[model samples]
Target: MTATVGALAPISRAACVGGGVIGGGWIARFLLAGIDVKVFDPHPAAQRIVAEVLANAERAYGMLTGAPLPKRGRLTFCASVAEAVADAQWVQESVPERLDLKRRVLAEIDAGAPAEALIGSSTSGLKPSDLQAGLAHPGRLFVAHPYNPVYLLPLVEIVGGAATTPETIARAKAVLDAIGMKGVVIAREIEAFVGDRLLEALWREALWLIKDDICDVETLDDVIRYSFGLRWAQMGLFQTYRIAGGEAGMRHFLAQFGPCLQWPWTRLTDVVDLDDALVEKIGGQSDAQAAGLSIRELERIRDENLVGIVQALKAGQGGEGWGAGRLLKEFEQRLWAQAGGGAPAPDPTAPLELLEIRVSPAWIDYNGHMTEHRYLQVFGDTSDALLRLIGVDFAYVEAGHSYYTVETHLRHLGEARLGEALTCTTQVLAVDDKRLHLFHRLFAGPERREIATAEYMMLHVDSRAGRSAPAPEHVLAKLRAIADAHAKLETPAAVGRAIGQKTRLAAPV
Candidate 1:
């Protein structure tokens, strides 16, 4: 039952054999991608826990991207493994890590699922070969390891066993890609794969730090989070080190730091004993660090923080070498294209509906409303949309002629809270060869109550010359057309208002 890439259809329905943390996360990821999920977990609390995970996933997804997503798929709790995998196009086995238990579950799923369906094991460290041993259609079985909070993180490690075929790996990659996951295929089955091995190494060192009483759990976390963790978020270790070479590059860096590797700085070669006393000490410290927050609360904090960091990266705030942010931006563009499709037809009779956005948790201030800065961002996005509508795209900008905002006046009429939907409508007030004036209004909810308004004056620039220039003829024609259509509507009163009110009385002493 080896399945080729061409044979694999977009997975409309998926099955999960276990509904623990990892399994439930898988269900959330699938459901968020609009794939119906059938889940089987023997524990009575499975349904409740999975539902909680799904809720968290929904929040994370809402904050991750502004691109429109498909409607959420259905979820069903099945009575048994056979029932769960019966009609699934993809079967994900996330049972316990024990080899025997996983093997039994894999066999059950293999027998029940269609032969053409791809079967993936969510084993963290167990070899896929052992899980697929003695199973029918073993070629379809492979490992699809994912990070925690699966719906938010995009990386998924795809590993195949001895009996697994290249076709199976290809099919798995295709499915993962469709769901907005980056599938890094392992050339050979290895213990813990790449990410876990790196994580395990760090975990071992962190444990030794605690065991040796060198630092508490909180201090260790701060050390990483406030320093190297930030560095790793964009450029990883190698690139960071290369930059540290101070004009000499990697060769110089290695020469200077190579000898320090022999120093007793790390305990990677030795194992730390996790005695009862040590475990209690570590657990107590962790609990105290969290204060009184529940697991769900901690997860929300984590997801929100992750979204903020990724968003920063996407904005290029982490600097030029931020590879992760660059990748994220590229991925979001793809999602936008998939959702928005081809260029929209110009409509002259009305204000152009340019941008639709969901207020991410990161955009909210301490007052629990969208912060003032985000209004500017929304208006900027709307302006960019208008540019695109009039034939100014990446190529136009690259050609050295594009619009640059010279001035903006924003009026905040109301408040927008987190997760609230926002839309921006743009009207081309006036346009000439060198300058364009736009008035944009922000509305909230389906009824479209006004939330804010922005008036922008932009000048066309020949970027190479660093001076004003007439826009290309095609772009000017489009803008003129939109302006002509908008002329039928009454001018907004706020369009020309100054920041201060008119003085009704003479200056008072």
Candidate 2:
């Protein structure tokens, strides 16, 4: 008996069979999505290792988005595969990539998990058909190969074996969507799925370059990192090449470059000898490139860089986003939907407490305080939060109407250092159909000392018409309600302060 894909409930409970790098990443991503996870790993250091990965994941997520994330789910370490899989909605096998061992463990999982529970194998280079050969419910097993640092990289190659059912694939995709992952289903099962196949070809050529002494590891890295690597990160290969074809497009690109495939420029199909000298040479060069940073340090640096790239992409093209950035924006919207469309209706009479920002290490400047522009960024975010509270959002703005800041007054009084937790409050000073007035206070630490204040005057504009316009009644209604409630409160002294006017910072809130 099989359940229709539509009948499948959202995945809330999951089981993992390994606790190394890949499996640890899987556990972290699931836990971050608020999915409870059960695990069985015989490694003695599994608990400590998984904890480190989860910490890194939490840090990365903080830098990724401001959307309200769900409460993190619980995790349990079990003594056996059967114990881990019991009652699990999904089971992921990420043990050593050996067909025989995977078959045995999956058979045990099939016996213990719910009959309809889907099973995913994290095999980088194994055909799922081989792993499913001996399982009683082979139709539920497939490959869900993910990249390194799986928590940060969103792509997952979903491949199903011959025995796998369409319903199973559909259900898995639903699970991926629920957790903000991008799963590209393979049309057929094969070893080393699409991503790895391309990576391996590149790896093969790269090794030959090193072995033949054309370039050392660092030089080779510099070549890629400084050139096509960036292009690959954004536009990808064929699309980048399409643009390279000029106005004639991909057809011209192929016509010009297709013949080069036969040239000896790449030794992609050739394998270099892994003799002791070559191995030592590569290892020595790699250590030199690392400059003695441990794996954890490197991982954190990589995570931060990835976050910066993704965030930039998310803000590109007038906030419409591009490629993976578009996916990330959509994911944040889904998160907002799950969290009741953002910050709840606040006490109308008081300043609306919108968000608390942890001063990231990245925010500190040469003088070791939050940089000047970040203050404006926080104020801008507060204004956007207010927009959402009043039924305005990305879709609202994209629909040809939005609030644009025409005037802003910002004052700074205190220093914000790394790791200092800061909170903000927004006060609705005034509002009408075509214009809005807002005041925000930035507070630091437990004492809630006011460190900064910002006032903004915004004009609603019809984007398509390129002129100021009256906002819709529905949006005006929510803003008016808050304005009315706040009208009774005394106005913040920060209001109407002239540029360069001197004033003492107030006491704690």
Candidate 3:
């Protein structure tokens, strides 16, 4: 009873069972991808909970990239599982951990869903085989484990049951990819899958440390956050250790540290007892660490931190930072495509109004104004919008050509407070086959008060060759059209201004 590769159609609508955190997240991901979602949860407050999660997802996704996203799809809360799966092309079951509850819910979903639709279980550790045991069409049922905050994180582990066909897995992967997710298919179905197995091992060790008084929860967290966590974000444990081998690689590193495997450094073999006293101690410590903040407040803090980390990874030190960064880049391109292929028809008679953004809390400095570097970021995004308008885009850059800013002059006229809405306008000052000169103005508030101005000289370059190059004829034609239109406008006062003292002193001897 497996859905053939051709049987699975593009998922324009989806059904989600049990609107808890995980289920709600799946709904958010689907809706954000512009897929209408029908959700069924027995809890009376399920709609409120799902709405809260959706709001957070919307905020996080908005901050994650400047590329436009598709208009949000409608979310329908259904009274019954049958109604939810009535017209859905994809059915996602995210009930409680109890096998009996899950089995019952999945059976109901299977009974109601379309025959060609694929069914996925959001089980953290349950094997897909067990979940599909008594199902009428077990071949269509598989585990699709997603991390928390599913809309933001791209990874989803897809584990097929014994009856599951490769075509089913391929269909699942295709659907996930359409929503900007990386679906890692497991070669075999196993308990806990991959990510949670590693996580469980670390969790056991962290528990032992706390029980043995070796380190408190906060201290243990700090150790990871300040040390190997950063390295792991970019290079995983193996690659990080391979670099430690210096000139040699993984083989040499393994040979040097292989003996450590026999050491008594880990408490993985034994389980830590969660006694009353230990539980109390851990709970007390956690409460103190939280400092009386509400759960919602803590969630907000965590989300902001995650956003900052992902953004840093996206920028990386060089270009692509880590696995997560690469995924973020790919997701941005998808968003660009959804937003009408990133093509903007600039009104060349006036400055091109390219971007409007609100200052995020993370961008605020100690003085309560947007940080200096963030201004540059806004200008950079504005430049990207301009490039997109003039036939320079991801495909153009992928072809080994792009514009590199050779010089920039920035003038700060006013301050942007946190949450202040701002807009950016760009004007083509001049253009040539190899160079582009542009000016940008940043305005804040309803009155559109000027906050900053930037002038940039950008050069077309063969990125692979690491040298300047002439713009392609098609691109040059677009730029020329823009320049011709812009030529009719008056030159900006800041265009050719240089930073200097008003009255220059006499030349030094």
Model 1 residue pairs with clashes: none
Off-target runs (Cα >4 Å) in candidate 2 are 1-9, 341-350, 358-374, 393-404, 414-422, 431-435, 444-451, 459-490, 503-509
Once fitted onto the true fold, the runs of candidate 1 whose alpha carbons sit more than 4 angstroms away are 1-9, 317-321, 342-354, 361-371, 384-407, 414-421, 426-438, 443-450, 456-491, 501-509
16-82 per-residue lDDT for model 1 (tens digits): 9998889999999898776889999999999999999998887776677765456677899999999
TM-score (all chains, Cα) for each model? 0.82, 0.87, 0.86
Query: After TM-score superposition, what is the CA distance of residue 164 in candidate 3 from its true location, in Å?
Result: 1.3
lDDT of 3 at 446: 80
lDDT of 2: 0.85
Give candidate 3 regions above 4 Å deviation. Answer: 1-10, 337-350, 357-369, 396-407, 417-421, 429-437, 444-449, 457-493, 500-509
Per-candidate total of colliding backbone pairs: 0, 0, 0
Cα RMSD (Å) per model? 5.4, 5.7, 5.1
**Error in Å for residue 54 of model 1:** 2.0
Best by TM-score: 2
Q: For model 3, how does the per-residue alpha-carbon lDDT over 1-509 read when each residue is reduced to its tens digit?
A: 00011111157889999889899999998987778899999898998999898988876765566665655677998989999999988899999888998999999998999988899999999999999978899989999999988887788999999998888899999999877788999989899999999999999999999999999989999999999998886787888999988898888988999999999999999999999999999999999889999876776676666776777787775776557777777777666544434334657788998887767666878998889999999999899878877778778899999999999999999999754668899989899999999999999878899999999999999999999999999999989888888899999988888886465677899
Query: On lDDT, who's better, 1 or 2?
Result: 2
Query: Candidate 1 lDDT (Cα, whole model)?
Result: 0.84
Task: Give the candidate number with the greatest lDDT.
Answer: 2
